[model samples]
Target: MENILEASGLTKRFHGLVAVHDVSVQLRRGEILGLIGPNGAGKTTLVDMVNGTLEPNAGDLVFEGRSVRGLPAYRRAHLGIGRTFQIMKPFPGMSVLENASIGALFGTNGGERSIGRAREQARECLAFVGLGRRIAQRADALGGPDRKRLELARALAMRPRLLLLDEVMAGLNHVEIEEVIEDIKKVRDQGISILVIEHVMKAITSLSDRVFVLHHGEKIVEGSCGEVLRDPRVVEAYLGRRRR
Candidate 1:
């Protein structure tokens, strides 16, 4: 399969600390690549680099066969890259439809130009993420799961070819997670490739075509879900050795 996004030897540093180091990853078109690691393992740092929120200290990011390392976040978004934040903060005093419409107004290919058209797009995206009933509700008034849905809907409104999901299921119950899993599958079915970072093991196991593990700012392993999960390296990283 063709790759929609590629990061080779990507590195990021803040002052004396290296947040990510020589980590490489690829998201194949229509595939969901799960990014997993313990806290401070650089998963979000990697996503930040890919989406242009942070410039890499070294290496390159390629999207659809071209280097986008020099582009700004908005430029990358217009180039078909969309991302959700680990910390969900909806626009204050804005309706859910209006919040999602922001994405439609500033999305891939410059998004929809007309406010009317953007709202229409937003509605479609909202409904797709099971938020149709709450479109008129204030964005900040929605609870945890619904806020997550709003975030997904906003990203979807961008019509992204590649979506970076940063812990979208962080605070959901089993049923809510299952609902999100299905929603994500539907997104993939629509041909959007995904790089999903999650602490939710069940969601990762169910959604990812492959899993990439990071540790101490480096690539520890990358393989099928079962293989990577069972690897000694991943096991040790997530859970300390059993005292024997």
Candidate 2:
């Protein structure tokens, strides 16, 4: 499969502080790539740049073989890029269905113009993420896991080509995590590529085709989960941090 998204020499700076430095990554057409790191590793910064939430101080981005540099978030969404924030934000005043409908209303290729068509597509996305039963409930009333599902549903309703999932399993029990792992796999089965940023070791091992590691905003290593786990640098990074 060809590369669906590519980031070259990406860098971000906050005043005098370097947040990300010269990082490069590629996401293939139909693969799940795991990005792991400790806190402040710049993983979220990289995703934000890709999703057009933040501009890179220096870098070039290519999506679907076209340059995407400087595009706004809405433009990126129309270009088939979808993302879920680590701290998800669902519309508090809307029903679950209404919240999801917002995606279909403004998704890829300008999305569905008719409200009825958008709602129909939203329902399918909700069902896929197991939020179908709660479609009528207020978005603010959902529990942690269901909120995660709602986040996924909204992203899926956008009909994206690439999904940037940032810790979608956070705060869930082991059973819920397992379900989410499976659900992500199912999402990839639909021919969408995924870049999963997660701290869960089990999810990384179970879902990643290849794993990449970042530390202090730099790419330290890239390989399979087992390979990354055994690397002396990665081992030291984790163990040394724990000792502090």
Candidate 3:
């Protein structure tokens, strides 16, 4: 299968500290790739570079057979890359539909030019993420899980070919996590490739076509979920020693 996204020798540094070191990854079209690691493991940093939130000091990023090394975040978005922050960012004062409309208004290929069109797209995205009932609510008024849905909806509103989700399942209870997992699968089923950063083991394991494990700013393993999870190095890096 052809890779939708590919990074080679990706490295990022901040003030002499290497936040991400020599990382390489390939994400195939229509596949969900789970990125798992401990906190401070540079998972977010790596995604930031790929999404154009941060410039890599060294590496090559290719999307859909084109190099995107010097592209700005907005340019990348225009090329169909959309991402959600680990920290949810909503237009707090705006209605849920309006907040999502921003994504529709400024996303891929310059998004929808008409406000009415954007709003229509926003409503559909909200419904897709199971947020349709809350469309009239203020974005800031949403509870935790709903806020996560808003984030997903907003990203979907961008009409992206590739979606980068950062920690979207954090703070959800088991049932809510399962709902979000289903929603993610639905999103992927629509032919959007996904790169998910998640600490929720069950959700990631079940959802990812493949998993990449990172530790201390480096990738330790990449393989099918069962293989990666059972790797002793991965267990030590994140899951710790098995309990007797």
Model 2: per-residue Cα lDDT at residue 218? 94
RMSD of each: 0.9, 1.6, 1.8
- Judged by whole-model lDDT over C-alpha atoms, candidate 2 comes out at 0.93
lDDT of 3 at 41: 94
**Model 2 spans with C-alpha error above 4 angstroms:** 241-244
lDDT of 2 by residue, 113-208 (tens): 999999999999999888889999999999988999999999999999999999999999999898899999999999999999998999999999
lDDT of 1 at 218: 95
Against the true structure, candidate 1 reaches a TM-score of: 0.98
* Candidate achieving higher TM-score, 1 or 2: 1
Output the better candidate (1/3) by lDDT: 1
Angstrom error at residue 152, model 2: 0.6
> Which RMSD does model 2 reach against the true structure?
1.6
Instruction: Tell me the tens digit of each residue's lDDT in model 1 across 65-118.
Output: 999988999999999999998888999799999999999999999889999999
Q: Write the per-residue lDDT of candidate 3 for residues 54-170, one digit (tens) a residue.
A: 999999999999999999999999899999988887888899999999999989998999999999999999998889899999999999889888998999999999999999999
TM-score of 2: 0.96
